[model samples]
Target: MDFAFTPEEERFREELHQLLLTNLPGDWAKRGLAEPIDSEERHALADLLSKQLAERKWLTMAWPEKFGGLDASYLMQYLFNEEMAYLDAPGGGGVGVTSVGPAIMMYGSEEQQRIYLPRIANADDRWAALYSEPGAGSDLASIQTRAVRDGDEYVINGLKTWVAGADRATMGWLAARTDPNGPKHRGLSTFAVPMDDPGVEIRPIENLAGERQLSEVLLHDVRVPIENRVGPENRGWYHVASTLDFERSGVASYARGKRHIEQLVDLVKENSTLSDQRQAVRYELADRWIELQVGFNVAQRIPWLQTQGISPNHEASVSKVYGSEMTQRIAGTGVRLLGMAGLLQRGTDGAPAGGAFARHYLTSAGSTIAAGTSEIQRNIIAQRGLGLPR
Candidate 1:
């Protein structure tokens, strides 16, 4: 496969870059740079960015025209995401925009598509993935969230933990056990639940950064209309798997990390007094570069695999595992390089890089666990990619 973007794709990249530069809210980026707390300010900024994305039809650029997407090439989508991440602009929560959008396009009814896709693109309907529970983390089939059908709606009851963006999400893509006696993977179903529904309760959970990055959601007989269900009943387990495949597929980014790596390199170069530290940083950063490149190559081949009607599951697992771990290492090195100053909170006066390294370190540590744990990804690589016995 060609590693080069065509001229048209290059033009598309420039167009999007220009759009971000021109229309992106200046105050939003300013507040992000100032507070950088991932708080209400960030949400306000995301709301502004989401509107801009919706206006440009960029929020659904990867979707088909029928669903309000631009039907662009994979390269264009990659460029868009890289640009957004590099600018520190909100990508509008990964699950709603990236993962569930594609799943809905594939499995949801016309009404479901029409109702949800547009809101995802334009409205501040942040979404959370309700797959894992306290009893079921890496092994998702062990999920115990139950949904029992009654008169016209299903009553959902259970707890979902470590659900990202749940504190602010307007809706959630929830997985629940619908058939308790069926096979482990065959008893589940997926539903789109309004986060503000009466029986739903959200309690924010702080991360290593001392920020509320995730949440614990409790459903106490939450009633969801049948129309909210996606795909066939008792088949939610498959839907969740499909959605995760989409999530893990987009992990690699040569360009998004490039600037940070360069910044680290330049810092090391300028501080020649710390020769040993600089050398270590250089060596580790070089390894990260290679890892990013490998991820990029694998990511590029994925489009072709999809075109040929393949799942790209194994390749995605490899990328997700390698990329997330490498990111943690890279950010960890950055924090070490900054020494005590790195541990300073974001608002500290004279903090190095305005405490960005510390933030990255904390955030990167969570990435490995979120999409899938490193050990779980390796299990997938061993079983699916290498054809080993489970």
Candidate 2:
């Protein structure tokens, strides 16, 4: 029941913290985690920081040594993610490192592994998860995207929406239907698709925060070699499910929430006007801090379960649902504390915290929707965790 990290893990955390402080731009905090990198300079800075992290082999530390990683423990990877999230640092490798790379390791062929794993570990290419389609998001089994076999290649045609980082990705970890006659879940297959291939189009989608970080990708008659298929044909549903489990651990979300709560506390303490309502704000902040800790503890269990050779399913759902909903609650509390000023957009003259909380308030609305909806997570908890009759 010991909750403390080992000495080596603590040292690694401190080293990563110092590395981020030294490498990040001075004004990086001002931009805030809630705001997307909208300018060329910010994009350049993100690219630079990503390269620096890759050089340190911290981007994919948990992967095997043969795949250009340090073979670090899962707990170490969790610590790394927590540190990066707290700082809002770039170069954690996004889906490329977290979901796609692990999925490839578990399901990809030897040739596919050799071709893609190193590039992912080295940050040579950004990858997007092309799974959710216009017609199929929460009900992923209903996806209509098709990848029909055509001799030595597969001809793909579909529209994938809500793809984060699609505009910047060099590759796509795609899921498409390969067998229409089978059950919805059994008919799907996964593929490693080149983003630059013919008939692939990426269009940005602006969210409530006015950020185009999410995009829609259109594929029409796009041809990839049969070698690009990752898992067994007509069995991609299970592979996609596993990939999502990697994403749902929610450690980073809790860490990010912790940072935001700390900033909110500082804002309340420093502002004379906010100090007038100190008692109420103090109670709210305390509640938020406590909830964040609870969520973080829930998230930490996932890595521990992995270390024990247990695949966390319902546990991951519990973490994701709590963390994402906690985010929304924290954002709501921040806006309420800021009063009318919370409505002010970023870059405004009198906006508080550079309008970070306002931006977060808008973006947090989607926290419950992305990855899987809150309702979906609840179902997982009920059916898988509680053993409820469905």
- Evaluate all candidate structures by whole-model CA lDDT and list the values in order: 0.76, 0.88
All candidates' TM-scores? 0.92, 0.97
Candidate 1 lDDT over 7-112, as tens digits, reads: 9878887887777667556643333332454567667767777888887778778778777788876567776776776666765446887777877887899999
Q: Which structure among the candidates has the greatest TM-score?
A: 2
Prediction 2 TM-score vs. true: 0.97
Model 1 misplaced stretches (Cα beyond 4 Å): 23-37, 251-256, 275-281
lDDT of 2 by residue, 39-152 (tens): 566567668878888898889889898888899998899999999888888768889998888888989888888989989877889999998988899889999999999999
Number of the predicted model whose lDDT against the real structure is largest: 2
Q: State the displacement of the C-alpha of residue 143, model 1, in Å, after optimal TM-score superposition.
A: 1.2
